[model samples]
Each structure stands twice: as C-alpha cells, then as structure tokens.
Target: MENFFDQYRDEVQPALKSKLEEFILFGYDSVTEEELWQYLCKKKWKREREAKLLYQIVNDILSVKIGEYMNFATVEAFKSPDWFGNQGKDELSKLL
Candidate 1:
C-alpha cells in the first residue's frame, strides 16, 4: 500500500509541477509545492476535476490580485483567435 501511494505520487508529480508552473505564471507568488500537492489531493487526482480545480484556484487568486478588473462578460474576451488560444495569454492580460 505504501509503495502504491509513493509510486502514484511520483507518477503525478510531473503533472503537478506543470500545473504549478501555470499557477506561478498567473502571478500567484504565494503558491508552493505543498499547496499544489494539497490541490491535487483535494481533487482526488482526477485529471479533468484537477484541471477545473486549478482553473478555480487561478481565478480566485486573480480575483484578489486584480479586484474589480477581473470580470469579463464577453465570450470573445475569453477566447483567442490564434493557435495559442486563451492558454497563451500572459499574466498581464489576466490582470486586464
């Protein structure tokens, strides 16, 4: 059982690290490895749910960091015309 958990964590760490990089890119300066681990655990390690949870965390952080400037009602504002898409938007756009 112990090995199973260890191996599982090892398998997931790469994905978690990638997600953590995205969080850091969002200007979430306070996020730590432990916090990312907690977020993964909170999602029970489900991929889709974990992605949604990460998005929520990023949005929540943005809500605090950008305040009233964070909300956008337009759908086009959420999308990108180029191949990069919304995922390619930088931290500055998140603030805008």
Candidate 2:
C-alpha cells in the first residue's frame, strides 16, 4: 500500500507543479511588480511543489485530487501567524 501510494505521488507531482507555476505566473502578470515578487517569494514555488505533492499523496491514499484537498493546506500556510504567505487561490478561483 505504501509503495503504491509513493508511485501515485510521483505521477502526480509534475502535473501539480506545472499547474502551480501557471498559477504563479498568471498572478505575476496581473499584479504589480512588488506584490508579484512578494507572492512568488512567499509561496516559494519549489517548496510548495514538494509540499503539495506530499499533501496529494497522503490524500490520494483515499482517492482525493489536488483541487479536492488544497484548500486547507493553503489556508493553513497562509494563516501561519508566524510569517506571511499567499495561498495563490486567486487564479484557482478564476478558473472555477
């Protein structure tokens, strides 16, 4: 079961990563330079990429996709109290 979970995670990581990059770039184009740069740095696309993959892998063991499970993580990452970060939800909301 664990091996199968790991395999599924590997498969989905790239797709999620690509989608996140698109989301970030979309925001970059629409927002001002300072805000865009702040969003980019805070989200740390690579870190978010890895975290999102792990998040999906855990959720996939129960058959959940990114869209189905990303909200909580995004909210949590944003409301960290310790530091500021954007959830990158605007672009996602635009799609929906």
Candidate 3:
C-alpha cells in the first residue's frame, strides 16, 4: 500500500511543489514536500487512493490548508520517539 502513490508522484510533483510553496509562504517554514506528500498519503487520501483520479489528487494537494497540514505534522511529531529519547532525564525534566 505504501508504494500505491509512488507511480503518480512524478505526475503530481508540480502540484506538490506549488502546495509546498504556499505552506512556506504562510510561515510554515519547516514543512517539506515529502512531508506534505506523506500527509496526503497517510491521512487525506489514505482510504481512497485507488478510487481517486489524478486530477482529484492534485486538487486535494492544492486545496489543503495550512491548519490541516500543520495539525497533521504536529500529530506526526508527537508520534516520533526521538523527541524524549534524545534528551537526558534532566533535560526532559527541564522541558516538563
């Protein structure tokens, strides 16, 4: 299922790039094209990838909002284990 969208990535690269630029312009400096693509694959189009047409996927990318993408990114960050593991106990305590 992971490679389901790889075939269309090249076809959709332009739309993805445009969407990424829009995110950056809106002050989402940390957002990358890959992350955006991941959000689309893992969230937005997760259940409908096979049924969706190329144009629809492009529309989804172009129409996604900053808030939506940021929310997805924040959740993804929280899911990563590196955040607390990289910090020592004292550093973690300081953060808390």
Candidate 4:
C-alpha cells in the first residue's frame, strides 16, 4: 500500500507544502513536509486499499488539521523505542 503511494510523492508535493505552511501558521514550527507526508502515508491513508485520485490525495493533505496531525505524531512518538531509551520499566512507570 505504501509502495503504491510512493509514486504520488512528486505530484503531492505542493499540497504537502501547503499543509506544512498551515501548520507553521498555527505555531507548529517544527512540522516538516516529510513528516506531513509520513503522517498521510502511515495514518491518514494507512487503511487505503486502492489508488486514490491525485485530487483526492491533495484534498486529504490540505484538509488535515493540526490536532489530527499532533495526535498522530504523539502516538507515533509513544510507539518509538527510542522514546524511552535506557529507561527501566520502573522509571517509565514513575514518569507516567
């Protein structure tokens, strides 16, 4: 599924840029085009079973809200093994 979407990277560049700009305007300065693309590929479009029209992809990118992206990012962060690098289970539990 991801391989199928990889072909649309260039075509969707503009929409990704537009969405990144929107995020920046809302004070999410750390957001990047690559991260936005990842969110779409991994979260927003993860369950897609068929090719989407270019316009549909563009709309999906442009329509993403900061909250949605943030939630996705937060979940991804928690999923990363490095998020708690070197921490013992007890230490992690204490932090939580």
Q: Which prediction has the highest TM-score against the true structure?
A: 4
lDDT of 4 by residue, 1-96 (tens): 456788999988988888888888889989988888889889888899988999998899889989999999999898887765565766988988
For residues 11-69, write the lDDT of model 1, one tens digit per residue. 45555566657656878556565555543343334344333344554443333322222
Off by over 4 Å in 2: 1-6, 28-74, 77-96
Give RMSD (Å) of candidate 2 vs. truth: 14.2
lDDT of each residue in 7-72, candidate 3, tens digit only: 889999999999888878888778888888899889887777356688987999899999998898
Which has the better lDDT: candidate 1, or candidate 3? 3
Q: Pick the candidate with the highest lDDT.
A: 4
TM-score, every prediction: 0.36, 0.27, 0.81, 0.82
Which residue runs does candidate 1 get wrong by more than 4 Å? 1-7, 43-96
Segments of candidate 4 deviating more than 4 angstroms = 84-96
In model 2, what is the error at residue 80, expressed in angstroms? Answer: 5.7
Local distance difference test, each candidate: 0.45, 0.42, 0.84, 0.86
With a 3 Å backbone cut-off (N, CA, C), the pairs that clash in candidate 3 are none
Query: Once model 3 is optimally superposed onto the true structure by TM-score, how far is the C-alpha of residue 62 displaced, in angstroms?
Result: 0.4
Off by over 4 Å in 3: 85-96
Q: Please report how far candidate 4 places residue 14 from its true position, in Å.
A: 0.9
